[model samples]
Target: MYRVMRLIRRFEERSIELVHSGHIVGGIHPYIGQEAIAAGVCAALRDDDIITSTHRGHGHVLAKGADPIRMLAELTGRSTGLNGGRGGSMHAADFGKGIYGANGIVGAGGAIATGAAWARRNDGSDVVTVSFFGDGAVNQGVLLETFNLAALWRLPVLFVCENNGYATTLTVAQAVAGSITARAEAFGIPSVSVDGTDARAVYAAAQAAAARGRAGMGPSFIECTAYRFDAHHTWEHKARVRYRSDDEVAAGRSRDPLDVLGLADEVRDRVDAEIEALLAEAVAFALDSPAPDPAGALDHLYATGLRTRDGNGLLDSAVR
Candidate 1:
């Protein structure tokens, strides 16, 4: 678990550098301070289980066993990307590994995951699914609706909310009325709130939830209270949003998740060094990867090997 947390930390740091260097266009929502939640929840899932993620989701994808090189390629929009360069940073997906997708829409993954779990159960598979979302998603109607369905059908889905204090510029207090857990409770879904900064606590909570879901118990929800130590988006470097005070930022940085892992200084240093090396290799692979050709943009839009008409309105007989 410690190693996985370290991997996510280094991956985010390297990804931030890539964004600044213009290697990753459209920028990214850095998961710098929220590594613990991804690491912990993924640790509790079986390899065959599924997960859906949000815009701030690179950490979740990485923690779920996505290859770093391919993830970096995806962010760089290379042909070797997880989505074949079609879905960049906010839309990477590795269905082979049970990662449904990293959705750009906030809170939409919950319903998608619920449906996936329901389908799997109907197919006689006991694979559970997890949906990772931000605090802002708590207000989304689809998420609430999915909660009701999951509870009613007793679907094997886990909802993990990474409550990082603010949703873009909006604070949780301003955006969310009433409590997050209470919403889950309304549907009779057992929910728990834990410190998002503590990786172990999240792992324990997720483990228990996964156990219950696998045992045919209904869905579960976890509200992980955490703080983002960086800007909400890389564009903040130019936009300069002043929603948070300097003191608050300083205080949040004080509780670094890496430091809280409780490993000895020597062990932590070794782990950091190893992760740095791995990130360097990942970046090199991403840089050397080929970009997808524009002519083949719709290659994987369909799974049946069928091709759609080109946007230029050229019929099969027009060229001949």
Candidate 2:
């Protein structure tokens, strides 16, 4: 858990540097402060357990065992990237690792996770699916609708909401009307809220929820209340958005999830050195990788064995 959280923290920090250095285009939604939520929850999952992530999802992807080298390459638009340079930061995915994708749309992953759980159940597989969303997603009709279906059918889906108290600058107090957990309770789904900074607490809650799902009990909801230590999006750094006060950010930074696991000084130093060396190699690999060719721009856009039509209605050999 400590290693994962530290890796995420350093990775995001390095990504921010890359953004400033012009290597990573379009910037990233840095997952700096919310490391423990991803690390702890993923710690409870099996290698076969599926997870759907949000736009701010680098932590979740890394926690689920994605290669940092390929992920950084993807962020830099290199062909060697996880998605062959197509998905970029917000859409990188490795299905073999059970990461469906990091969705750009808010609340979209809920349905995807539910569908995955339902399919796995039908396959006679005991695998569970976890949907990681934010506080902003609770009111999304799609998520609520998924909650209804998941609860109604007793799907093995765990809804993990990373409630960082804001929906892209809108405070939860301003946006949420009532209790965040109550929203899930309304659909008769069991729910719990945990300290997002405490890795142990998150792991315990996630383990219980995953166990319940595996036992064919039904869906569960976990709301992790953490804080966004950096800008919601890297663009905020240049735009200088001032929705959050400096003092509030400072106070929030005090309870950093990365520090919750108190490892020995020697152990911390060794891990830091190891991660630094790994990130150095990852950055070199990303920079050395070539960009995708324009001629094959349409590749991977359609399903395999599917054909396309040209203007005259004949099969498009170019795509074929």
For each candidate, what is the lDDT? 0.90, 0.94
Q: How displaced is residue 288 in candidate 1, in Å?
A: 1.1
Off by over 4 Å in 2: 305-320
In candidate 2, where is summed lDDT lowest over 10 consecutive residues?
298-307
Name the 10 consecutive residues with the lowest summed lDDT in model 1: 311-320
Evaluate model 2: give its lDDT: 0.94
**Model 1 backbone overlap count:** 0
Model 1: pairs clashing at backbone N, Cα or C within 3 Å: none
What TM-score does each of the candidates earn?
Answer: 0.96, 0.96
* Model 2, span 1-320: residue lDDT tens: 98899899999999999999999999999988899999999999999999999999999999999999999999999999999999999998999999999999999999999999999999999999999999999989999999999999999999999999899999999999999999999999999999999999999999999999999999999999999999999999999999988899999999988677777889989888999999999999999999999767756667773447665778788666
TM-score of 2: 0.96
lDDT of 1 at 163: 96
